[model samples]
Target: MVRQIASRLFYAIVILLGVILVVSSLVKLVPGDPVDVLAAGNPAMTVADMEVLRERMGLNRSVPEQFVAYLGQAVQGDLGTSIRQGVPVMTLILERLPATVELALWAVVLASVIAIPLGVLTALKRGTWVDYVGTFVAVLGVSMPGFLLAVLMILWFSVELRWLPASGYRGSALAAFGQAIIERDPAVFWNAFRYFILPAISLAFVMIAVNARLIRSAMLEVLEQDYITFAAAKGVPGFVIVIRHALRNALLPVVTIVGLQLGALLSGTVVIETVFAWPGIGRLAVDAIHVRDYPVIQAVVLVSALLFIVINLVVDGLYRVIDPRVRDD
Candidate 1:
């Protein structure tokens, strides 16, 4: 296991380096230079002035030289400054990371808590009305895009009902929880909950459907295995037979999907974040793209790629834990 983990870590490092190179290269390919954006409103700025700024920013260097210098700086955790904002790219990401993390956690928790049980119930009650309805709902969830659902939710819940905020993340939920503890205020918890609910639901809806469908399929497959038949013949309780015997085996694939979705969610909530005005990495990336901030865009993509690699690595370790057979493989 130690050797396997070390190998995976090495691969992860290599993949991250490739991601940095690809993203940095692609950002350069984007039309409209950052220099052009910066010089837009400044009538007095000559082409000579812009050339000086470019040299100062090291944009005058060849692409390969820039990439090498970027790699050297990145090793020391210096990801470079944003072209537009002029702040360190890493600093902006760190400030926004917590919000994205919080949003992703909320999304995953909501999807898992709802989908797992629904899937189990549907599997156990196959061919019944419950199963039929669940399958239909899952299909509906998958068919609709998250942004559309978010808009509908805002219109119905936020606009009409006034239940939750339509957009915006006030701050990290952990900070809210800490404040709740310090001030002994329950409303802080509620306030955070209200702020998070809409976006979480929006982000989670499709994943919840996907998880439910996958879990159902896995459970059905596990239930048909010889061991499940043996358990049934031994007069095991139905719930135990399902939960202990079937669910454990079924969870291998479900865990894989969960890992993939969770990883994607951490960095891929661009639409939901934009719709809800959530201050996350996704929104930051979007802002950077609009202004052609190459440094910020590269930094954000690299951070996201690293996150995805870490999540998959953790998931790989989990596979060995959940199924000892995986360790042998």
Candidate 2:
């Protein structure tokens, strides 16, 4: 296990370096100079002043030299200053990360709570209308685009019904709960939930569909195994056999799906966040890209890649816990 983790860490470092190099190279290829963006807002700036600023920000350096410098600073936990905001990239990321994390967590939790049981039921009732309906829903979810779903949801829930706010983010439920405990106010939690529902559901819809399908397929396979048949032959209760024996074994694939989708959700929330006007890293990254804020853009990509790597490592570790066969191997 220790060796596995060490190997994964080594690979993760390599991947992060590649991500940094790629992002740094690509940002330069983007039209319109960061220095020009800076000078645009300041009309008093002359061409010589722009050149001085460019040299000062190290934009005049070759790509390889800039990448080396940036990588060095990044190694020391300095992501450098954002060209647009003139603030530390890490500070901007940290400020917005909690919202993104909260949204992703809520989305995954909601997906798991619904998908796993629905999948199980569909598999168990394979020939019934329940199976047909679950399959239909899963197909619809997988086919529907997240941004479109988010917009439709806003029109239905926020515009037509006016049941929820159309746009804006309150603090996350966990943060609100802490505040509620301190201030003896429960309204904080409710506010967070209300703000969370639309965006979380939109983000989770595809994951739920995908996970449910995967789980259903896994459960079907698991239920057909010799041990499952033996359990029934031994007079095991149907529910116990299904839950304890079938579901437990079937969850390996579900874990993998959830881990990967959770990572995707973290990085792919850009459109949803923009639509909802949510104050998260995805939106921040989008804004940074408009002006080619290299530090902020690179930091967001790096952070998202790091999260993806870490989640996969966690999923690998979970394999042993979920299946004894993995540990034995």
Candidate 3:
């Protein structure tokens, strides 16, 4: 297991380097010079000024030389200064990282809490109305685009019903909870939750649908196995048989899906964040792209790729825990 983990880590580093190199190269190919974009607000800036700026940014160097320099700085944890923000790229990312993490974690938690039961119920109910309803929900969730859903939800829940805030993030729930403990005020947490509800639901919509469908299918297959049949024949309670004998075995595939989706949610938040005006890393990346801010864009891409690699590694560890066969292999 240790050897396998080391091998995966080595591959992950290679993949991350490849991603960084490609992003750094392609960002330069984007039209409109970063120097020009930077100078747009300063009308007195001249051609000479732009040239000097380019030289300072190392844009005057050959691509290979620039890449080597960038790679060395990256290894030392310097992602360079943001062209647009005029701050360290890593600093900007760190500021927004918590919001993105909070959103993704909440979305996954909401999806799992809702999806698992729905899936199990649908499978157990089979041809009943409950099953039909669950299937319809799954289809709707799968078919609806997240942005569209986000818009419609804003209209209904935020604009019309006025139950939740339409846009913007309050502090994360953890921060709110900490403040609440310090001040003896519980409303802080509620405020954060209100701000979180719309975006979390919007982001989680597809995940819940997909997870439900996957779980339903896995449950159906597991229900037919001889162990389940024997458990039922031995007069085990219906709940115990379903939960222990069937659902536990069915969860292996669900675990894989959830892990991949969690990683995807990190990268997939751009649209949702934009629509909702959530101040997260995804929104930050989008803003950087408009002006072709290479440092910020490259940092975002590298960080996202690193997150995906880490999630997959964690999933591999989960496999061994969930199934003894995985350990043997």
Local distance difference test, each candidate:
0.88, 0.92, 0.90
Q: Point out the worst 10-residue segment of candidate 1 by lDDT.
A: 320-329
Quality of model 2 by C-alpha lDDT: 0.92
What ranges in model 1 sit over 4 Å off?
181-184
Residue 172 CA displacement from its true place in model 1, Å: 1.9
- lDDT tens string, model 2, 167-217? 998777888889888989888788888999999999989988988889999
On lDDT, the candidate that comes out on top is 2
User: What ordering of candidates by TM-score runs from best to worst?
Assistant: 2, 1, 3
Q: What is the lDDT of residue 180 in candidate 2?
A: 85
What lDDT score goes with residue 99 in model 1? 91
TM-score of each: 0.96, 0.97, 0.96
- Order by lDDT, highest first: 2, 3, 1
Q: Provide the global lDDT of candidate 1 against the true structure.
A: 0.88
Cα lDDT tens digits, model 3, 235-314, are 99999998887888888999999989989889779999999898888999999999878888988998999999899888
